[model samples]
Target: MKKWIMLSFLLIYLAGCQPFMGGQAVIDWVDFIQWNGQEYNGVHNSEIADASFIEKEIGEVRFKVADNVSNPSYQLKDGDAAFHEKGTKLYSIKGKDNIIAVKDEAAINGYRIYFAMDNSKYKWHFDDVSLEQVKKIEIYKSATPAGNQQIATIEDKAGIENFLEILSNSKEAPAFQPNTSTGDPISYQIILYTDEPITYKYSVHYDGNTYFWYPSETAILSDDIQHFISEK
Candidate 1:
């Protein structure tokens, strides 16, 4: 009798613990399937099924982006990189290894910092893009790190530790709001996901209309710069 009762309770708990439909777990990707009113064309003396089946698949992925300007280290990819989007002068930095892409330093809106580690292929892949995950980024148009500004210098000793703590405890990547800093009417956002630990850093800039997503990875050469420039 005790065993039966324990088993019953365990089953009930497990049922409630089941993840959301379509494997909506923090680590699993799901595919959506739509059955068309068609038939499977193949037949073994069987009539063609009058249904079309469309399956949407999503894979588990993870991404991370870190602003470690002091560390001259990274893993790079030597692939054909380009800014495929139109109307914007977005750029990307990439190469075959981590160090090749590391340059002396670069500046965005007067701040010199290293590229965020996000463009590598080995770590980041999305089987399906979730419309619900997309967000309208808010760029801090004249916000700067001042006495009363929200932009905090991440270079301090405890700053890095605090940032890492946030990442470890967060269910998703924390969004960066430029409102904390004063700058060239521009701000950056770092997006993260739980599928896989692949990071993509973005700099958002507007030209009167749409906002652009500039890849934050560093380039190995002038040619490499051409690969990651994109507009969205």
Candidate 2:
């Protein structure tokens, strides 16, 4: 009777702890996560099902218990990276590694910093056309006290080049999205008129801190550009 009771107790204990043991404790999903005091957000991933292990092995992400999690799944802990739906926490990603590609079929393609060992690739890709080819840019605001309105129109060549320079230096975010949950979103409508037959339309999204080209994967507004636009 004693032997049988001991066996039953052991089985019950094992069953209770089973779900927590998957060889590795990876969360099912997380919007974003804080690691080593830095925030990585706006995660995008390509699901290569049954994909071969990546050999690039850029960096590693270690999950630790924390008090705050902007995204629910992230607060739970998992890989080192944060993304939207299919972001994976990679302990060791393959490549120069850690920077994830964000591709938009409509306008542009860019990259986001993900689990980076250092802040190297965290700048906008700003494939802006040559300044000489640019004619002017018209700026507008969407959420305003007077409703959407034209804010400024920049036709000066020097001003346009200055804006483009600042944009190139703007910092790249790990994971970023337009957050309108608080106040009215800080947004701008940028219609760039160029010499080419194509007139490019971009956005200026201010998250109370920095500005981003909302539809883009990684285009942040520059300070000089911000000032330049403000003056206009």
Q: Name the candidate that leads on lDDT.
A: 2
Best by TM-score: 2
Q: Mind giving the per-residue lDDT tens digits that candidate 2 earns over 136-222?
A: 767767666665567787788788877766655667764766667787557665666654323455567776676776434665666
Summing lDDT over every window of 10 consecutive residues in candidate 2, give the lowest-scoring window. 3-12
TM-score of each: 0.20, 0.40
Worst 10 residues of 1 by lDDT: 39-48
Q: Give model 2's TM-score versus the native structure.
A: 0.40
Candidate 2, 14: how far from true, in Å?
Answer: 37
lDDT of 1 by residue, 129-176 (tens): 232332221112223453112222233434334433332332321343
Residue 42, candidate 2: C-alpha displacement in angstroms? 25
lDDT of 1 at 118: 34
lDDT of each: 0.23, 0.46
